[model samples]
Target: MKPKVIRALGVVSALLFLGVLIAFAQPKGETVKVKGEVVDLWCFLEGGDRGADHKQCAISCAKAGNPIGLVTEKDEVYVMMGLKDHQPGKEVLLEKMAETVTVEGTLVKKGGVQVIYVSSVK
Candidate 1:
């Protein structure tokens, strides 16, 4: 093959490899439903804070723009995001803070952190 043709082929091969890597790196969102208690990240991580009794405080923190987290029955915790139009937006999580809830949304795990883009909470 001509040298120039070989170089072009190599470039194309490199681009294809990069595309594959990116696809694996960023996975598409998948619908998920989990039962857990939504908690204010601050108190939850610091003092083991939780329980329906702490509902008011958890809601307050969340309303104040604090990060919200969910603790599942298996003791797994995940960062929760209220997504609207593909961005962080409206939330049904704050009101359920510190209370057991069943939520449905897209679950994503990256960089060792679990995040759920919340859609509905009940």
Candidate 2:
């Protein structure tokens, strides 16, 4: 093959390899722990929401005559465990909002959203 063509092929191959590596390097499914204030919980049931935006769902629920059961924090590092099986309110077992506690569960991504399917809390 021509020298220029060979070099271009090599560059393309390298870029492709890099892309694959970056993709695989991301965490798939793992156990995680998170601590924060319970801000919203019910909207999570309808699906299509997760992460920082969870607070919005909480607020929305509160306005709509439903319990806004979501945990929110400014700097709390949520140890995200991949998705599992658990009810909305029963998943995270803290009684009040702003209560400091630890939650353990599988960090799962469903429909391009990351959430911890809580297993236990304290």
Candidate 3:
């Protein structure tokens, strides 16, 4: 094989390897159907705020652009996100703030933080 051809092949192989590594490195999420309470993350995590009494405040925080999250029956918490980029996950959960609701989405965990890209809420 010509030297130039061999060098081109080497570069292509390197690029292919890099692509594969990047793909693997990305956190591919899993689909989930979770029944939990949608809470304002800032108030919930900071002060353990939740329930009917906190509903109004939760809504206020959501309106103020605080992050929303879900806390499951088993005490698992997942930061909620939108299914697409440049969108806030709180859109769907705002009305359900401080209330228990079922949510369906893709859940991804990285660096000890769990995030769910919400697809549906009920």
RMSD of candidates 1 onward, in order: 6.8, 12.2, 5.3
Error of 1 at 97 (Å): 1.3
User: What overall lDDT, based on C-alpha atoms, would model 1 receive against the true structure?
Assistant: 0.79
Q: What residue runs in model 1 are displaced by over 4 Å at the alpha carbon?
A: 1-27, 85-90
Arranged by lDDT, best first: 3, 1, 2
Report the C-alpha displacement of residue 99, candidate 1, in angstroms: 1.3
| Candidate 3 residue-wise lDDT, 9-122, digit = tens | 999999999999877754478999999999999999999999999999999999999999999989899999877654686777787888888988888989999998888988
The number of the candidate with the highest TM-score is 3
Model 2 is weakest, by summed lDDT over 10 consecutive residues, at 77-86
Candidate 1, position 72, lDDT: 91
lDDT of 2: 0.52
Which segments of candidate 2 are over 4 A away from where they belong? 1-28, 41-86
**Tens-digit lDDT track of model 2 for 32-106:** 776665544454446634455454555455455444333546533332232332245433432333344667666
Whole-model Cα lDDT of every candidate shown, in order: 0.79, 0.52, 0.87
For every model shown, what is its TM-score relative to the native structure?
0.70, 0.40, 0.75
